[model samples]
Structures are given as C-alpha cells and as structure tokens.
Target chain A: GAGVSQSPSNKVTEKGKDVELRCDPISGHTALYWYRQSLGQGLEFLIYFQGNSAPDKSGLPSDRFSAERTGGSVSTLTIQRTQQEDSAVYLCASSPAGDTEAFFGQGTRLTVV
Target chain B: AQSVTQPDIHITVSEGASLELRCNYSYGATPYLFWYVQSPGQGLQLLLKYFSGDTLVQGIKGFEAEFKRSQSSFNLRKPSVHWSDAAEYFCAVERGATLGRLYFGRGTQLTVWP
Candidate 1:
C-alpha cells in the first residue's frame, strides 16, 4: 500500500462485546505503532512492533486488550469485553527502519455502546 | 518518562494573520520532534519534523517549526494563516535511543475567522 491502511473505518459494538480493528502498514516498513485517541485527548500509545515482534506493549490499557502482527505486514488489535471508556479512534502508523517519520492511517473509530 | 505539552487548548485567528503554536517536551536527551495537523473527518498529516542539523525545519502546507534545545520547545509557525488551516494541531516527540515509541501532547484547536 502507498500508506498505512486501517480497516472498518467505524465500528459500534455493545458493551462487553469483542471487537477487532485491523491495520495494514506500508510495504517494507520495519516499524508499526498503534495509538488511541479519546475525545479531547492526546494520542495514547498502545503498542509497537518491529518486524513481527512486539518490543513495546507498555501502553495496552488492560489485559483485555491485545494485538498481534504476522509476517510484518498486517496487524490486528482485539479488545475483549469492551467498555464505554474504550470508545475512541484507533490509529496506526508505519515507518522505515531506524529513526524516521511515520506515516499514519485513517483510523478506525470504535464506539463501545 | 518522555512527554509533550501543548499549553493552548484552543486558539482563534483571523485569516491572513500570522500564527504560532507553542509546544514543550520533557526528555532525557535530545529528542525527535514533530508537528501534525488533523482536519475534521481526516487522518493526521505531518506538518514538520526536526531531528538534527538546522534548528528550523520546513514542512508541507506552508508550515514550519523551530526546535529550541534550551527550553525543550518545538513551536510551529506560519507567516500567514488561511481559513483552510483551521484544524487541530498536535506536537509529538520520540526518544532518539528508543526508536519507535512516539509521545504526543494534548492538541490545540485552531479556529480561523474569515
């Protein structure tokens, strides 16, 4: 892809239900990142992957939230037993190897009702 | 811990007026700084970035930012504003040694009055 791509532009799930958001990073980019943006809040870092291995998962809000990336191409973020507070836009980004500017995707707007 | 601070939550400026957005960061060492703009119903777009070399960096959409190490500030500025420039602006920082983790500040909403 020319840039990072996120699927299911919007998702509305009932409270306590599970939801999955997907992100497809740019080709050959070695680093991928996930972030959550709540209303009137800054981007909260969630996790980061380097070549299919997650070196940083420090920002996952709870055990219910987990993510995985396979083949260093596509990633999935699963939120189990969603809560109202989990409603936010989930963003994904990818960058080249080493220190570089990341290109972002059109985020998935998740609404936990 | 690394963090970015954007003091102004909202700002209003008349079209054609000059504009400036302030940002500050706290990091152990010299950090990578960036400015991003998010328009309504759109994804974030990179405005500018600074890693090293010149303190001043230019970006797309006629945006520019200056990095000041003394104050740990990277402020975005434009000589003239446009109505289309109305959007939310965010400041972000990355730890040079750490690589991929990027920290962001609370955004600043800019309202351009015509």
Candidate 2:
C-alpha cells in the first residue's frame, strides 16, 4: 500500500469482550509502531516492531494488550478484555527504519461500552 | 525521563490573525522535534520537523516552527490563520538513541473564528 492502513475504522464492543485491530504498514518498511490517542491523554506509544519482532513492548498498558507482526508487513493488536477506560483511537505507523520519519494510518477508533 | 509538554489546552484566534502555539520538551540531549495537526475525523498530518541544521524549519500549509536549544522549546507559528486551520495540534519528540518511539504532548486545540 502507498500508506499505512488500519482495518475497521471504528469498533464498538461490550465490556469484557475481546477485540482485534489490524495494521498494514507500507511496503518495505522495516519499522512499525502502535500508538493510542485518548481525550486529554495525548498520543501514547504502545509498541515498536523491527521486522517481524517487537523489540519494544514497554508501552503496552497491560498484559491484556498484545500485538504481533508477521512477514514484516501486517500486524494485529488484540485486547483480551475491554474496559470503558480502553476507549480510544489506535494509530499505526511505519518507517523505512527506526530513526526515520514515520507515516501514519487513519487509525481505528475503539469504543468500549 | 523524556516528555513533551503543550501548556495550552485550547486557543482561539480570529481568521487572518497571526497564531503561535507553544511547546516544550525535556530530554537529556537534543532530540527530534515535530509538529502535527489533527483535524476532526481525520488522521494526523505532519506540519514540520526539526532534526539538525537551522533552528527555523518550514512546514506545509504555511506553517513554521523554531527550535530553541536553551529553552528546550519548539513552537509553531503562522503569519495568517484560516478557518480551515482550526484543529488540534500536537507536539512530539523522539530520542536520539530510541527508535520508533515518539513521546507526544497533550494536544492544543485551536479554534479560528471569522
């Protein structure tokens, strides 16, 4: 794709239900990142991936939050148990390398009801 | 610890007026600075970035920002504001050693009134 792509632009789920958000990064990009944007909280770094491996998961909010990337192309973020506080916009970005400027996606807005 | 700070939560300006958005960051060394704009129901767009070289950097949509090392600030400025420029602006910083991790400040929402 010409730019980073995220699936299911918006999702509304009941509390305690699990949800999966997908991200497709730009082709040939070696670095991928996930961020969460909430009202007043600003953009929070969630994870960073180099190739197919996630080198930095320090930003994951909890154990329920897990992400994986395969073939260095597509990635998935799964929230095991959703909570009301989990409602936010999830953003994905890709860069040619770790230190370079990243291109961002439209993001998936997750709403936990 | 590295962090970005945007003190103004909301700002309003009349159309065609000059605008300035303040940002400050805390980092041990000089870091990569960036300004991004997010319109309602739209994704974030890069406004400008300061890596090295000249402190003043020009960005899209007639926006410019100056990077000051002493103050640890990167402020965005525009000579003339437009109605369409009303949006949420964010300031972000990346560490020199850290890769792919961008620390962002609480956004500043700008409202342009005619």
Candidate 3:
C-alpha cells in the first residue's frame, strides 16, 4: 500500500520444483518491474509491466521463466523446474510513470536447493 | 541494447574521506540515468536520477551525481564518507522511454573503515 511489497522474503525449494514469487506494487503506480540479483552481481532486468501487459520480456533467462500481471497492481513470477543457479534475490519495483524514479521492495530471496 | 559499466568492483575508504564511484553507460539516445544504494539485508534505495537539466543532481544521504554526456558517464560523489555509507552501489540506464527497460552495472561495494 505504502510502497512496493514482495512476498516470501525467503524461499527454499527443491532443485526440480517449481516456485512462484509475488509482487504488489504501490497504489496507483502505472509501471512495474521485476529484477533478479545473484550473489555478487548487479540487478538483472527480468520484465516490465505497463498496465498489466508486459511489453518487454527479453530479459527473461529462459522459456521456463514466466510472469504475469493482473489489474495493473499485482504480478507473479513463476519458474518451472528450478535450478540451483536460480537462487537469488527477486526484486520488484514500481514507478508512477514510465521514465521516473521507481520505489523498490525488500525482495524475495529464492534458494533452489 | 543498453549496458552499464562500473569500473571498481570494491572500494575501501576511511571515515570522513571523500568518495567517488565511477559509472559509464552505452545507449543510443540521451538516457535516463540513476544511482541506487543497497545496504546489507535491505532493499535498494534511489540515490539520484538524471533525465535532463543542469547535468548535476543531488540526492538523499548527502550524495550527488554528475551526468557527462560527452563521456557517457554519471559518476556519484560525496563530500565526506561515513561508516554507515558502506553498502553496494549500482548504476542503471533506461534503454528507452517506451520500453522502460533498465540496464544495470555490476555494482561496486563500498567499505568505509573507521
């Protein structure tokens, strides 16, 4: 409500299991983004949503990674057959407009065991 | 495609010392630049942003960044460093206004020694 919110601050899953990470952007925000940060790495752009439609999904690592947004408010990232390398912090951010500063959430730490 | 480069992977500075973190970007047009800080176990917070204007932008935590179009750089600076300023810093560039795709650098870890 106040800022971007992400669920499951920490997640542990089996190597082949699938997992879903959720992101709730700030109220009235029109743009949302998802990013992945591996240990010792920078933020990797995963996707961007402009009013519940993803205009750019080029950053998604593989076909197994899919994401969707509904009602322009909440988004979910799904990973099928997770791998150990998938372990990282999944961050969500939302901006009032397309080209403005974005507020971020604490992120979901996913650890694929 | 756009990309960001941060030269220093890690840096150490004593408390009260001046600090500068270098960042460079490659984009087709005038890009939207930003600097973000991530403290340990915390989310990333915006330090400053540059879209257009004086080329100099001020941000919270007593930090400032200068955008040099000629050099394709947006370097972040602080007059004096504090121990609490120790964190990981990232530089990013918006590829285009329509796409809203952001390319981020590999980040620089700042360690302030007392």
Candidate 4:
C-alpha cells in the first residue's frame, strides 16, 4: 500500500512570503493531520481533517496558518506572510480512522529567511 | 487541560542492556496513551498505544509499554536495546473520543552505546 506523501521536500523563502505545502494521504484514509516540528521541539499540532471536516484548529499558531482537505483525500497547508519563526519541518499523517494508528509522510522542511 | 510529559530529555543506554523511558500524562478523564519513535530526518513511527483493556501492550521493534492508571503513567520498555534504537522518542496522550488530538511531550533522545 502507498504511504502518505508530501511535496517540496525542502523550501526556502524570504520572510513575509506565502508558501503552500501539499500532502497526499493514503488511499481510503478519512483522517489527515498536519503538525510542525521545530528543532529540539516536539510535534506541534497544526490542523486535522476528518473527512474534509476540521473540528480542531486550536493548535494553529496564528491566522496566517491555514489548512484544508478536499474530497477527503488530499490536504494543503498554506502559510501567509511567513516569518522566520515559522521555519520548521511540516509533517503530515493519515490514519484509517480518526483515532487509530497514524502513518506519516517524510515532511516538508520550510525555511524562512 | 490534557498534556504529556517525558521526564528525561535524554538517556544513554549500553547495547544489550535493559531500557526504560518514563512518561506521565495529565488528563481529565480516561486517556489514550501512545509512544512514537523518530529517526533523524524521518517521520514519527508508532511504537505502541494503550486505549483500554490490558495494561500491557506490545509494539513493533521489540518494544512494549505498560499503562498504569493509578500513576497516570504509560512507560515504554525494551529489555535489550540495540544500537539502532538510538533516536528521539515522544510520549503522547489524547482526550478520549476526541480523535485523541494527541498532546505530545517534549521527547526523550535516546543514545545507545556499544
């Protein structure tokens, strides 16, 4: 079976620029999650979608960060006006169901200068 | 509020020796506990999870975890650790029935010596 895949393995951008990261979840998965991992820090929850419905967005650090999952398969996380503080590895994961074991993607390393 | 705690930020263990990684969690109600391992430049891999029933659960890579409700702990253990086991381990807790949003700990960086 195909695992979760993420695009733009590495991205370097200037501050105040906008960047979009893509995630393709496993086939038939109904749950998708996005998290940020800063160096020497734990995984910080960003947004999660269960069948295209995001019931939890509280983990999103600010309004500049937003994510959406459409057709219950793919998800996109967009950062508007990125800041140096936003530089980190963005990871995506998906599970068969909302509360089951999750499979992860390699992650996109976003660097803001 | 729900939270996960990994007491040791780093631990060094000798190869073929016993190992244990402590995890404590704070949750209002019954909690879902999980342990994940991440190698450098890789995503997190689920080591094990404890939802309900048996307090002891087995996981991949010869790992196991015991859930102690009284102490609010779910500790991971591996009797004989291998050098390849060196990596960052994260302890997570979830609010029951809420997709277990997974509150992660700061993580424990394990170092294996030969």
Per-model C-alpha lDDT, please? 0.92, 0.92, 0.91, 0.90
| Segments of candidate 2 deviating more than 4 angstroms | none
Q: Which residue pairs show backbone clashes in model 1?
A: none
Whichever of 3 and 4 has more lDDT, that candidate is 3
Which tens-of-lDDT digit does each residue in B1-114 have in candidate 1?
667999999999999999999999998788888999999867788898998999999999899999999999999999999999999999998885447677899999999999
Interface RMSD of each: 1.3, 1.5, 1.8, 1.7
lDDT of 2 at A57: 94
Candidate 4 residue lDDT tens string, A1-113? 38999998999999999999999999998888899999766688888789999988888999999999899998999999999999999999998874567788989999999
Distance from true location, Cα of B33 in model 3, Å: 0.6
Predicted chain A of candidate 4: TM-score: 0.95
Best by DockQ: 1
Where does candidate 4 clash, by residue pair?
A: none
Worst 10 residues of 2 chain B by lDDT: B93-102
> What's model 2's lDDT at A31?
93
**Cα distance off (Å), candidate 1, residue A53:** 0.6
lDDT of 3 by residue, B14-64 (tens): 999999999998876878889999998788899998889899999999999
Error of 2 at B97 (Å): 3.2
* Residue pairs in candidate 2 whose N, alpha carbon or C atoms collide under 3 angstroms: none
| Ranking of all predicted structures according to lDDT, beginning with the best and ending with the worst | 2, 1, 3, 4
For each candidate, report what fraction of the true interface contacts it reproduces: 0.70, 0.70, 0.62, 0.50
